[model samples]
Target: MAITSDDVRHLAELSNLSVTEEEIEPLKKDLGAIVEYISQLDELNTEGVEPTYQCFEMENVWREDEITEFEAKRKDLLNLAPESTDNQIKVPKVL
Candidate 1:
């Protein structure tokens, strides 16, 4: 696919970039070369190759969720708070 000035301009607009007139030609050449290089992948022959998802042999290590006792007590935590009422920390009202 040929990268025209309009294509470059459209890309710039989509990317929220401000490109000058001087940068248009260079951008067009650069983008065209990149697309051409990537298009080489179309020449590859993969008849029965499995698509790769994860590059590494890694998986989720899940463990059973168990409730554990905490060292800090509720009363102690409440006392450390800047302000607390009704056994809960109080903060300034937000709009």
Candidate 2:
């Protein structure tokens, strides 16, 4: 898991990162140590352990679906907009 100067340079180029030459050695050492620590996980024994994606069970607390009628003002809805023509709201082009 020891990352060399060449490895750092290759990684930087792949990621399109402009890394100065002085920063390469420190980055390589840091990344190499991280890989070394992650590889240590292989030493753990998880035999007979059931695999689980999440720790908690998920359920949605939602209100019951019900329909109700209410009076709406058409003029109030139209007046909320700054610009309207022929009962249609006008918007500027996005693209």
lDDT on C-alpha atoms for all candidate structures: 0.95, 0.88
Error of 2 at 55 (Å): 8.6
Clashing pairs in 2: none
What is the TM-score of each predicted model, taking all chains together?
0.51, 0.45
For this target, which candidate reaches the highest lDDT against the unseen true structure? 1
Per-residue CA lDDT of model 2 for 23-91, tens digit only, reads 998898899999999999789998998989777887666886887655767777888899887888889
Candidate 1 lDDT over residue span 1-95, tens digit each:
89999999999999999999999999999999999999998899988999998888878878889888999999999999999999999999998
Report backbone clashes per prediction. Answer: 0, 0
Query: Looking at candidate 1, what is the lDDT of residue 56?
Result: 80
RMSD of each: 10.0, 10.2
Quality of model 1 by C-alpha lDDT: 0.95
Model 2 spans > 4 angstroms off: 45-95
